[model samples]
Target: MNETENDYHGYTPMDYDEDSAADEAYQTCVSYIVEHAPIERDDTVVDVGTGTGIVALELASKCDRVLGRDIDDEWLRYAREKAAERGVENVSFDHGSFREPNVEEAVDVVVASYALYMAYDEGGEGTLRAAIEGISSLNPRHLVVADKMFFGPPEPRGGYETLPRMGTVANLLADTGFTLTDVEIVSGSAGVLVASRTSG
Candidate 1:
């Protein structure tokens, strides 16, 4: 396994569940992303950085198919295990990343939570832009991003100094042909952004 896979506080696939179990904000973000993704019964949804397939599994019933992508192969394995244990057939977990989701040329919707920062926090601002643009290129009609982001003064929190700013992401989305339609601020630093494709 890659050392960077768990470098973010030694997070294993199980820890994602455990963390949400312990952090209300985290769970809120996760649930909110699934509930407000604008997924249709015939839609195909791709979830980036799908740590353990929690969101992918929950969304399978709402969409025709769900693709869960993660940089860590172990996380994908764990996600597959969860899908099997839950008898979720429409969701597939695979190796992918925020920068290269490995999805089809077009999808109905793309959703990510507690994962976007991996683009910025790990790779910096340019990577974050590429990540968002990559998702835009998928031609998904909508995007739902939920993570610990700055809603106020930009400052380090939870030991992460490069948290994405809500405004910055919104601007990038708009530049990439998406428009912000809704936002749910779970906390000062945790929130969800819902945007729709407006051009092309």
Candidate 2:
């Protein structure tokens, strides 16, 4: 199950069951972000590559607004539908890539859960640099990133081999002018990092 073969775009369902592992992972990532990043009520957040409103909707509950951005129209529609179903008024879904998020205002926080590394893997160096720059342009106070960590072998996922190590990710954030605040790697080989802008 190389990454190309098991890519979410190819095989993973657009939506996950309420209690499935995928849903749990989403919840776990959101929980970690909320705990470490601590969004304020007056803050606006952007959940980049937010599939099905998982992180976006959750952030909406704690912030003034949340924009869920993704390149997949189907996933965006599903996120919109889910937000409507939950009567979550502060959350909005939009079709966009992380490299060019098209957000209108400076957001207080930007979160990418299991999404940024995928952009790095698929789009290569240029995309990753663009993504970092795009996020920086938002002038976010905090940036929370959550993605898988390969401890040994490339766990059957297509691009795990290309996924940057946790330290490498931290270095990238530093290069983009963010200060690393906290980091944690879960037993499941997934990790979360929180970084803050010096001026923010």
Candidate 3:
């Protein structure tokens, strides 16, 4: 997993699920990403930071397939078990990080929830740049990022070092052939960004 401001090492998969279920802002981000993303019925989607595969599983019903990639094995195991229990055959969780998302085929859309800041924490903007580029390589037409990124000035609830500003994030996406199309601020320190692939 990318270096993160908070660690999930102590929490069981069920515990993580319960906490995220209780977090209104986090839920808002997930909903906003799904609602705003330009996904088609036949599209294949890749969730770059699929912690417990929540976002990936959510998108599975709407899209043809969803591949949830994360670096955490425990989380993937739990996610897969949940998928089985729910009979969600269209979604799968596998090991991957933002910079190396092990995507074997092309995808129509890409989504990331609360993972980009961890990229920054791992190696600053440099790592984030690589992560964006990596996602771009999948040839997705649309990208949605929901995380504790700043839509305004850094807030007290977020860390200055890890909370990336929207402007910087947009510039990095632009460098990778994307145009920042829309934004939804879910809370003081959390938001969603919708970007579309565009010619440079």
CA RMSD of all predictions: 2.3, 3.8, 2.1
What tens digits encode model 1's per-residue C-alpha lDDT throughout 19-68? Answer: 76899988888788767778899999998888888788888889899988
Q: Could you tell me which residue pairs clash in candidate 1? A: none
Each candidate: how many clashes?
Answer: 0, 3, 0
Compare candidates 2 and 3 on TM-score and give the better one: 3
Worst 10 residues of 2 by lDDT: 1-10
Cα-based lDDT for every prediction: 0.81, 0.73, 0.84
* TM per prediction: 0.91, 0.83, 0.92
Q: Judged by lDDT relative to the true structure, which candidate is superior, 1 or 2?
A: 1
Total clashing pairs in model 3 = 0
Displacement of the residue 67 alpha carbon in candidate 2, Å: 0.7
Write model 3 residue lDDT over 1-200, tens digit each, in one string: 33242364577878878989999999999888767778899999999888788888888889999999888887789899999999999998888877788999989999988888878767878988988888888989988988877877877744445677888888998898889899888876788889998965
Candidate 2 TM-score to native = 0.83
Compose the digit string of candidate 2's lDDT tens values, residues 87-139: 99999888766667879887899888877776567666566667777777888
Report the Cα lDDT for residue 120, model 2.
Answer: 63
Q: For model 3, what is the error of residue 126's alpha carbon versus the real structure, in angstroms, after optimal superposition?
A: 1.0
